[model samples]
Target: MAFLEFTRLDERSVIEYVKSVAALSSILKLDDEGDAAEKLTVKEIGDGNLNFVFLVTNSVHSVIMKQSLPYIRCIGESWPLTKDRAYFEAMALEEQGRIAPHHVPQVYHFDPTMSLIAMRYLPPPHIILRKALIAGIQYPLLARHIAHFMANTLFFTSLLFHSTLDHKRQVAKFCGNAALCRHTEQVVFSDPYQISQYNHWTSPYLDPDAEALRHDNLLKLEIAILKSKFSEQAQALIHGDLHTSSVMVTPESTQVIDPEFAFYGPMGYDIGAFLGNLMLAFFAQDGLVDQPDHRKAYKEWILETIEDTWNLFYKNFVALWDEHRNGAGEAYLPAVYNNPEVQLLAQKRYMAELFHDSLGFGAAKMIRRIVGVAHVEDFESITDAAKRASCERKALNLAKMLLKDRAKFEGIAQIVSAIRQF
Candidate 1:
């Protein structure tokens, strides 16, 4: 078997390259002795910026083949991308699978040389939660599932699962990925908001009126949010980009995907990203919920999910801290070891940081969907401008409130109260 080198293959015949590059020829079962080893049927499926995702199906099974190109495919010659990104993504996904096996796709094979990944194909009934929200659908268990997912995945992957030295080693390895994270900080946060000729909004969704408003005001706010998020540097390994589109789901299941941007960064970035998208969905409920009662019910679910997610995350995080108490020594607490008041004070400080970050990132995420180039699917399908605008306004109001008073805001109760004002 040939050991693949990801950069050698040209993009012209990607499918043939994928088949030859992966371990499929030897590891995947292709029977009947002479059937010409069934070629992978591939088609593009996502609107992501950094990679090319194909739905690959063979006779026996279905899978997704995700390729990380040196530069974004859509941008073509305008910008050059580093093929090394494929290497980082493969590593990130593999680690995430280990951390949250049930909530992520199974990595069938990774061809670092070819810059491609082969993974289990989850089905359609499981759409991106953002798209589902656009259709006005609700997943009653989303908050619980996501909260657990965040708590378990983030906590264990950091200080809890490994010794301080071990965790530091992991964080250091990922920190080498600074280039990719810098790009994200620029593209998703910085560049999108800058007042420049290069940035412009489009169509029934991004009209001149909205574009000017975003350029004049919204961009500054988003940029500030991005700067603060990047500055926090709690420097733990993070998914880096966690939003509705990054997640796949059905009524009973939720799966998060696309960790190509994975790197060590502020912990709040991940939490804020997920919560921000959920808040966006809540505001867009006007277009999503068909019946009045259903709207109210779904709204409650969103709020409950927010509160429940925070609570569940706190509980699980504390459980991890208890198990790793010896390792957590001095980095976070005094030597008292069992003082209730000391523990409570530490808990208050940690939750306070979480609350602040969540609020800031949440605000940034909601506003960017309206003003940035990469919009959310929650309101993409809504044809009514008046209704959509109203929903967006509500989301914007929540974002403003959160950003202005994130540090002062205490719990889910206060955050929900602020969101309700919108």
Candidate 2:
């Protein structure tokens, strides 16, 4: 359990491992000579696909310990992955924490050899944002908080704040996390469109829809551009899997977790992943109830969240760019962008492109969740197959339209209106 090398840790063994590490044992007050170890409890959590997460707690303080399995946990050893994702997760936590510590968990310890990391525990009442969405819980401040997070994290890491030398060095380092990036390319960008064995849907209900996607030449072309952008763009450090489940939240707190897929990629990938999942939650509301408005007004709230998230993100992101204009960022220089009018136009053009990119990426994310290997529980928990399929089809159709015509969408309000049409 307390081995010096990597071993698959379980409840009993994890306790021994924790007690062996002072930083962890200190939290539980575990003294080798005392009964403190016995008082500590270890509860395994997370339904995630890649890691083993456990909550090790004493009578008072608690800490979360996570270890990466060398394979996908949900798919098992058939799909082997690198244990080194723990290293990237640690790196991302450190960097993102530096930029937005309030939104990210603190890393107390990282053991590269063991592929393990221990960090601040987000206790009860702090639920996974996806689960909370399905449960119809609302975080009134979620939009503002997420805006601050994306704006600062993306802006601070990009050329606007970093010199080319520093940015490229960081990018080169993250290139080591190629395994996860390749996996994303497959699942998110590739598998869903082709006849991949891993792809599945509501089966007979979505069989036609899936077939339609497979044969849609224009849609395939659209996705191809996005996949290439994902492969080539190094706009900023993005939380590659910024879907709803990667977030933990309460009424007053919103914590972003799982940057295991973090990389230097298109900033809109993160923005789109978030907004796409929120859209999924919105569509799932339709099939989620036997009676209309069973959770009355929840859909409207979801719509507001989607709209608010984009709008606030736009505002905050631009604010940061303006504040740091005279700073060290290389993308836009005070000399070249010398005038007030030129700067205004540059910012407008940038935000407009980002807005469309977010829509396109968000739509792509929605497609994958429904028809790819991993499905969101929002639709899964709908119980009745027909109802769930009904929900999924609407989301699927909307996603297809967005992917093809994301450029046509002028604003978040228009996207919200389109969501209602389905």
Candidate 3:
């Protein structure tokens, strides 16, 4: 087979492309010496707004093949996006996999020209976390596993682990991902606050609320600050889209996928995205209720999960800081922060800021899902408009409060209490 030029792949073309690539064929044991190619099955499974994902499998082995199209999948060719996002996704996977191997999938091969990546396939019993949350299914290790993943990946990639020279090198490398970053800035921060064609809601029910959001001066001011930090703070190499849908989980195994928006940004941005989406799921539970009790216990569980995720992430992140305080980390020098009093003060101040950032960013994510272009299934899957709007309004109100007064929060417990009160 000869090397083919860049072209959008379909079900038929994927098979030929796979067979032509020795690395992919070898994964399925489908080389000239093997017969798997004759019996191979390929299924297109991408349901995202950005890429084409295929499940390629044979009788004995399987791998996931993801190819980036030159445009946004949901809006069609009218919105031209770079297929080069695949390259960034592959790079992030390799780097994040190195830092948190237990939670990241392994990459087998990458083709820059084709904008494709062949990687490990997470088989059955593994499903998107958002789907599991909607079904009210519980994963025992989800909180612990995700906490560890965030801590390791963020800590190791930040100035706390890397010297200034190394950190700058990485920051420069990811700057090319500005396009995706711009998209996030628009949808997550800018679009919701203005009258844009992409902005939407549950219609008449949320019309007034959406309008108020556009005119709220305090909310706009707060969001502008967050936007500035998001663009200026290169604190770590973050999974820029760490929502529930980006996570794949079973009772024991957790894997993160689709890091096409990976970039050097505030670590709290990543933490906030996950926590915010979980909150969306929590509020949407009202619409999913079938009994009079209205899933009270499940709601409590969701709140607890939110509290646990943040508390665990803080504990683990602080532990990493402690363990590496005397190492080559350039953020806080041992000579300057050597005393116990100073270390305690520094850690306390650092944690306080992070907590606020997480709350603010989380609130932004919640607001975006309700009024921004891309809505979450947690709210969208509900069949009843009135019920969905009610749940979304509660979420939207809570998010507004959090975004404006996040600095008042001292701990995750306080945030959880606020959610309950709302």
Candidate 4:
């Protein structure tokens, strides 16, 4: 019950806390073996902006404990954040894991009092997908697994599967996640556009480009439209921060983590976030193509993965919508779309809009990574400043185009083609 005091955990304190909690202590086999708790090893490995992540292991088992502080970890205590984000994270993971168990890590225990969650620790070789992409590694099943994850998670949480009454209840429950949602709205959709303290870039190189973004009236108009959807649309329960770093993968496994920012929002927001990060990875390849690390083929693979992910998601999502056309979903009544012709027409219209939404959101994600508060390691790892700037400019330009012209793009193939041209 000491955890009920709400003091932040240190190495010494975490061991004491674990010894006091049966759910965590049992996982380390402390009950079966008298000395198990004494043999446990714990190391803090949080590198993200928001939370403290510790990897705890005994001889036979390991678990990841994530604790949210009352402020942004990267920005320090001056920028306060709610530690209660852990509650929403635990809730989202449980719901999303039910829909896509294979793609999500199992949540073993969650401690709301301590603002902590203990989950399955992804073992070595299951690196973050962003790191894998940066290393020029190919995950053969990456596209298929991610597409399946997006389809199942998005469809099952949306109006396609939930009745109007149930959907509203779910939405109302998540609306309390307003703090994290506002963080996303400011960082992703707002900050990079105007002068803000958090915004930075490959400065002298992108000086004009960054200034141009501020003054571009047309671009601001488009961003305003996308921002409205991000704030207003409750189409589905989305993994709010679905960037590459949020995914852990190997040749065999792909696991999504960090739903602390999760809430009900536009489904395309999740899909676009993943695709956009992949595109950033592709752009950063040019900077990494030095010596034996020529990443031309890997760059091609990233593009292919991006194209395949969207294409497969489309196929699977539409299939789900068709299969459940007569279900409890209240989006399109069965009587209204009963005829084959109307059903086909509805499908086409729905898909077209989703595709455009995905493109626009994806483009915004890319732009933010390059010039916003948080920069991606894809470009950051490149030591040469000018070389890094070049890669970033290409990505930024491509993203701007996509944001403005996404409506013209009919499919993922066309988007892939534009990436190639850039």
Instruction: Report the C-alpha lDDT of model 1 over 280-307, residue by residue, as the tens digit.
Output: 8888777765554668877777777778
lDDT per residue for candidate 2 within 1-422, as digits (tens), equals 45778898998888888878888777777765667778888889868988999998887579999999899999999999999999999999999999999999999999999999999998779899999988888899999899889999999989988888899988987888889999999998999989998999997899999999989999999999999999999999998999999999999999999999988999999999999999999989867777767865998998999999999999988989889999988898898999999999999899999998898899999999999999999999999998899889999999999999999988999999999888
How close is each model in CA RMSD to the real structure?
Answer: 3.6, 1.2, 1.1, 1.2
Question: Per-residue CA lDDT of candidate 4, range 14-74, in tens?
Answer: 7887778888888888778467877888899987779999888888699898999999998
Q: Candidate 2 local accuracy as lDDT? A: 0.91
Error of 4 at 137 (Å): 0.3
Global CA lDDT computed for model 4: 0.91
The regions of model 3 sitting more than 4 angstroms off are 1-3, 32-34, 292-294
lDDT of 3 by residue, 1-422 (tens): 35456777777788888888888877788865657888888899998778899998888698898999889998889888889999999999999999999999999999998899999999989999999999988887999999999999999999999999999999998999999999999999899999998888999999999999988999999999999999999999999999999999999999999999999999999999999999999899888876627678888888888999999999999999999998878989988887999999999998899889988999999999999999999999998899899999999999999999999888899888989886
Q: Please report, as a residue range, the 10-residue window in candidate 3 with the lowest summed lDDT.
A: 1-10
Candidate 1, residue 316: Cα displacement in angstroms equals 1.5
Comparing 1 and 3 on lDDT, the stronger one: 3
User: Each prediction's TM-score against the native?
Assistant: 0.86, 0.98, 0.98, 0.98
lDDT of 3: 0.92
Q: Would you list the C-alpha lDDT of every candidate in the order shown?
A: 0.70, 0.91, 0.92, 0.91
Worst 10 residues of 4 by lDDT: 288-297
**What is the alpha-carbon lDDT of model 1 when measured against the actual structure?**
0.70
Judge candidate 4 at residue 222 and give its lDDT: 96
In candidate 4, which residue pairs clash? Answer: none
The segments of candidate 2 whose C-alpha lies over 4 angstroms from its true place after superposition are 32-34
